[model samples]
Target: MLAASNRLAGAIAFGLALTLGAGLGAVARGDHVVVHRVGASAPAPTPSATPKPTPTADRSGTVSQQRVRHIAEREGFAFLRPPGRNGEVSRWDPCVPIHYVVDVEIGPPTAAADIAWAIAQVSKATGMRFVDDGTTAEQPDDRRKDVRHTKSGWRWAPVLIALVPDSVFHGKGLHADKDSLAYTDPAIYSDEAGDAEIVTAQVVVDADDITDGGHEDPGALGPTLLHEFGHLAGLDHVHRSGEIMQPDGGGVVSYGPGDLAGLHYVGRAHGCVADAALPTDSDDFPR
Candidate 1:
């Protein structure tokens, strides 16, 4: 137990991983991409069951599919469901709240506001609750973690939001590629129903991108934060010019209609189970 406590306080290895963009092919900007490779095994296919039709209604913070489809078609949307995998992008189980731990050291002043606003937006858009589990000294790691050391009082790893120097990352070469602002690597896993859900994630910012982008780019930090969290929410880059999920620069500090549309699609699954097991120790999402 003493050794485990020390281990929690020590440097946790952050393994090298292919950029999440690599999953969609090499799309991360610049040269400094740092995606943490989580589990390497594929989840066993569960017994086949009928998937219900997608929902369409605005209730308790969720938007209607009619509205989502309209927005998706008009503003454009990127359907990044895994390859050879059919249908829409996977989602979190809305039945339970997603708890996150934000490392308060996220820096350069406006960090707190940006983090708050981003999380609020995601919660509002998805109808999925996100309760902040406070700050930590933890650095991002790709491996599975002890949610919390019941005996030692070490907090479980949550969604990390760290401010890292752009010069230190692979996607931040010329200072700002526009696309180098921030990135998220969601630690995905399967729920009881054999569906994929984002159990934990990392939303790291490139500090130099804001610094190099010049004066008061701090305001722009909100969008980058929102974009990274959007990744945590299971969104991929859309070609649309106005959406927050745009591969390049986008229109607002807020999520556009299309971004919300995709969020609507990925917020919750069509089925529910009587019980669920927390998925950190598991492998890649259900296939």
Candidate 2:
């Protein structure tokens, strides 16, 4: 369950609880997410398993698109949407590879590697690419930072994946769950046509939730990262039990077939806009 900013949260309600799944298999209830201060950074990825292995191939660990479709039809998949009884799907104007950064305050020894692994899986499934902006010193804030151009001329805000202590969320007495494995804040932008597009996002995991953090096994942490990034990629929780996008503490560890199908559709959107284009005053995606 990924949680957006306060404003975004207000727009979501029980929707964006960040990455609530943890391979525990439990439907999330009362997804009270902590609205922490904002922060983001970057770095090269290096997991303990190996230098980031290639993303799963069509016939790799991830299920095939055919199977994904079958699963979705049999069970069903969900996309993150704007608040309301209606499930209004929120996707990028045109599906495109996404860039991101990794800011680590704490995590497993293979944290970077775990991130890389998760990236490969998502990229393989959605045909999306990830960019590591190196790293940053910004502290985590619950509010959304306006994305724009930095003094360096690069896009100011990119997706940020951070490993932080629980205190960062708990200390603030944020409304998030105590067993919060990780959460994400994906900034949703609308196009001139009033369609939602996800440009930049942030993912935060409890440093203490992973094996190195005295919670789950080091290897088990990869699934948590994958699930949160899934949220970043515009996925919503499904009632289906054995999926990565299930409720918090779910044990799905990897993207299920249904989850993969939704990702493909999201990545398949038509995005003519620049990956980092700022909304114009003449016409902008509703902020």
Candidate 3:
């Protein structure tokens, strides 16, 4: 869990581990160490684009696309798997719009607006497109299915961001340590060539913590959401202060220069999956 002396200190942490069957799994909190595990599993097939006769709506509501871009970078950033000889960094396909949904059943009154704001922030930083599927009563699950049959049709499950209570948080296998404001579980699959893509993810925020912070105050729910979203975008914790990817919040309310650079590295401007080039050295990764 991301620990802090107080909310103002903005504690956060992230962890990564390999799993069998479907894809790689990673978990993030605030202020924790990252662990990696490797084992052989059949490579999952790459996701193909939605077939013809696409539905106009999904579980979140009417589907619409929103895209933004902000390119910049510097030192003091890191990834779950830094780009270079180690392997390719896993990211969402830039050419496709990422669809997401919010579960606000246990959230504060401002939950919806706060989430929209944070998503926009991440979208701008990463040049990723997002489609809000609106709200759902769906709960967070570590073993959530990657694809589900919806009224529109069968499609990849949209990212789920749930505001959950302590009971649900502990019960749902979110693995949130004590006092963790939020955590993320991202599912990544590698193709035959060893390239990886994040297919779906879950973001679970502690409802009690947000209530205590009143959601909108500095070092409150907003920044926490942003930090977890960073994890969702394939970033891991950095020890540097002033970066949103820092293990602890470091009193930073937004993505710093290093964070922007990291996002750019995984974002559309870097290249979409089909045409994206692999980084060849440590210089391609954040220092």
Candidate 4:
């Protein structure tokens, strides 16, 4: 089920689902500028009759554990999901490398380089590593799975970053307006202990807004890409000036001091999440 709210400048929508014994669920929200919240529920998937293998930890502890230099200005940053009573906010497992793929079918010529630049900035801020899987034919899906079956075996799905036409948003049950620059949907997993981790996410940009002629121009797509990537990294919109996580992009091409601080808080400096388990095939989503 889904619920939506309207504002003078833009619209916001939310979708919620509950998945029974699997303890899996999702809460989705999106907007052009103004943010709103809504709640709804869906029937859970029936549990598989056959017992499944015990879930194992995916963190390898091989990634370098480097702490980011503390930033003096931290007031401008905020988390999309605020910290729980345990003082931990949802974030990706910093020990594992985040894999991603690009769908450039409708992207500008500079799409590849532009994405790399933005990811590089985020990587520097957070100690999280990202592996580029090059281009993929896969399109964006709001109900994307946490893992995919490959010839080698089952592994976590790669983060998808795509440049699609505005019309594509009209389908896929997405709530963004045709004029919205971009939208990001992150799949998260939480345990009974209240610890949560973002397993995968999707970043979709409006290809129509970024054409070949102005692809290289400043602010054409850089700020928007960074803003959405920040969302993928769990940073939420902040009204403070000069921050890339601003609701309207804030006309800034790079991350501000607060953005850096927030990224570090969710970054590798926090140490590995050894007990974080990757969801199995039977585990239903928004987990």
Candidate 5:
């Protein structure tokens, strides 16, 4: 029994010695312990990534056709529309072409005040003298009171600058059967009219506001007038945005250089007698 107790005491002593040795080792390694934090915000958790905004179509502002026309005329391009035509056009006429006699009836013409302002802008930019043949700032309803009839056709002057309020765009007002279209000579450009007799009348369709890129009118004011003038100048819409003859008017302001070049070519070279019979063939108008 004494021998068994001695063995147990030795074992206990050995355990105590091992424990003491471990404590000594820990003491020797003082300040060597590494502490790690693992809390929710221990290192200031990064913010979740924010989502980016999706891209959208531009729907910001509106533009005026008159402003566009002013830009064209300012750039030394004479903007003329035949009495009644659709689409837009720019031309430089050396002589009064048969088409020049036509007056494009711009619906919703501008108010008197606006008209004067537009004329002033045109005069300043174009440096061409504009003769006002009509009265000032009359309501669009009374526009017919100032109409003057001519031998070749009727002349309505003082370009309508203001658009009618809440005016919706109908199609071109010109047709063979429409009586309101008084200047309906089948010979749009013929041998009868002298070169100097062809006169262009500018008409503005007054509307409450101009349309935007999305809700554009096919026969709006500036576009309509320009288109008619192209016809008067013996050119048709080329379906090219660069050309003023383009039917679909959008964000563009004036005829590109190509259009001006074409205008010079057609106005000086192509005459009503020679080019009148050709069908309106151009692939360059606005689609």
Candidate 6:
């Protein structure tokens, strides 16, 4: 009777293991490392061995392809990654890295006159000038996970207002829309080489909500452009209020001393390993 009962118990345990989809088979039994043999999508166990941080990729290659010409010495910010929901979560997040790329779209029948007006508006708000008279081209549909549409700073082609049905300026942040200002990943992107999959910004213009202050719009669409440009230019938000990065934006229209330093570092050097030593913007990042 005792032998029969022991056999029955073993059978029950084996059945329980099989029922858990194999992934949970390695039931933890105290200090021992339980090796679960589940499906292919199981979360990777944290390495028990000495953890060496993944080395950032070298960014020497593709020098000619970058968009921003001058990198300033400002602090840096990160682009956000796509969050995978459901069973697909493991395939991403800590895995499917996000990249940073900014693209502007134009509205249809708007023509050169409209784009010129828009550029003039943006330039006036930010106190920057655009004298480039480059040729125009059609914007591509698939602007995500691809680099073909990306144009280097020197090769900027002015898009006509007529070609774009609408226009919106975008800035990089955690959400799909720039309604909130948060970055999900800051470190993973610092490497520079593995940042293509990330999203820098995406904006669309609403005819009703346009403004000259740029901050007048909720997207802060104007500031968003500058903010992302600052990132590309290598500026991070400083902790000061009345600065461009402060919430309830106003007054701080131009890049502060901190902003300039960061921009110089990134635009000129492409990397500012010692950016912390440079300076911090007195204005805080948007809350």
The number of the candidate with the highest lDDT is 4
lDDT values for all models: 0.50, 0.52, 0.58, 0.60, 0.29, 0.26
Candidate 5, residues 173-269, lDDT tens digits: the string is 3121111111111111111121111223333332323332221333333433333333333333333445444433223444455445445534544
Task: List the candidate numbers ranked by lDDT, top first.
Answer: 4, 3, 2, 1, 5, 6
| Local accuracy of candidate 2 as per-residue lDDT tens digits, 89-181 | 455543445667777746667777888888888777777667676766665555545343344332326777877777875557323344455
Q: What is the lDDT of candidate 6?
A: 0.26
Clashes of each: 6, 37, 9, 2, 34, 47
TM-score of 6: 0.32
**Cα misplacement distance, residue 23 of candidate 6 (Å):** 39
Give me the overall lDDT of model 1: 0.50
Judged by TM-score, which candidate is best?
Answer: 4
Per-residue alpha-carbon lDDT of candidate 1 for residues 157-274, written as tens digits (9 for 90 to 100): 5667777664543342322223355566555444333344454666766655543231223336666676667667766666566676764435355787888877766775444322
Q: Decide which is better by TM-score, 3 or 5.
A: 3
- Score candidate 4 by lDDT: 0.60
> How many residue-pair clashes does candidate 2 contain?
37
Q: Between prediction 4 and prediction 6, which has the larger lDDT?
A: 4
Candidate 1 regions exceeding 4 Å error are 1-75, 83-88, 143-156, 171-179, 191-194, 211-219, 268-287
Candidate 3 Cα outliers beyond 4 Å, as residue runs: 1-74, 84-87, 151-153, 211-218, 275-287
Compose the digit string of candidate 6's lDDT tens values, residues 75-189.
3211121111210100112111123222233322332344344344334433333453343343322121111122321111122111212222222311212332211111111
Worst 10 residues of 3 by lDDT: 11-20
Candidate 2 yields a Cα-based lDDT of 0.52
User: Stretches of candidate 2 above 4 Å error?
Assistant: 1-75, 82-88, 93-96, 151-156, 173-175, 212-219, 269-277, 282-287
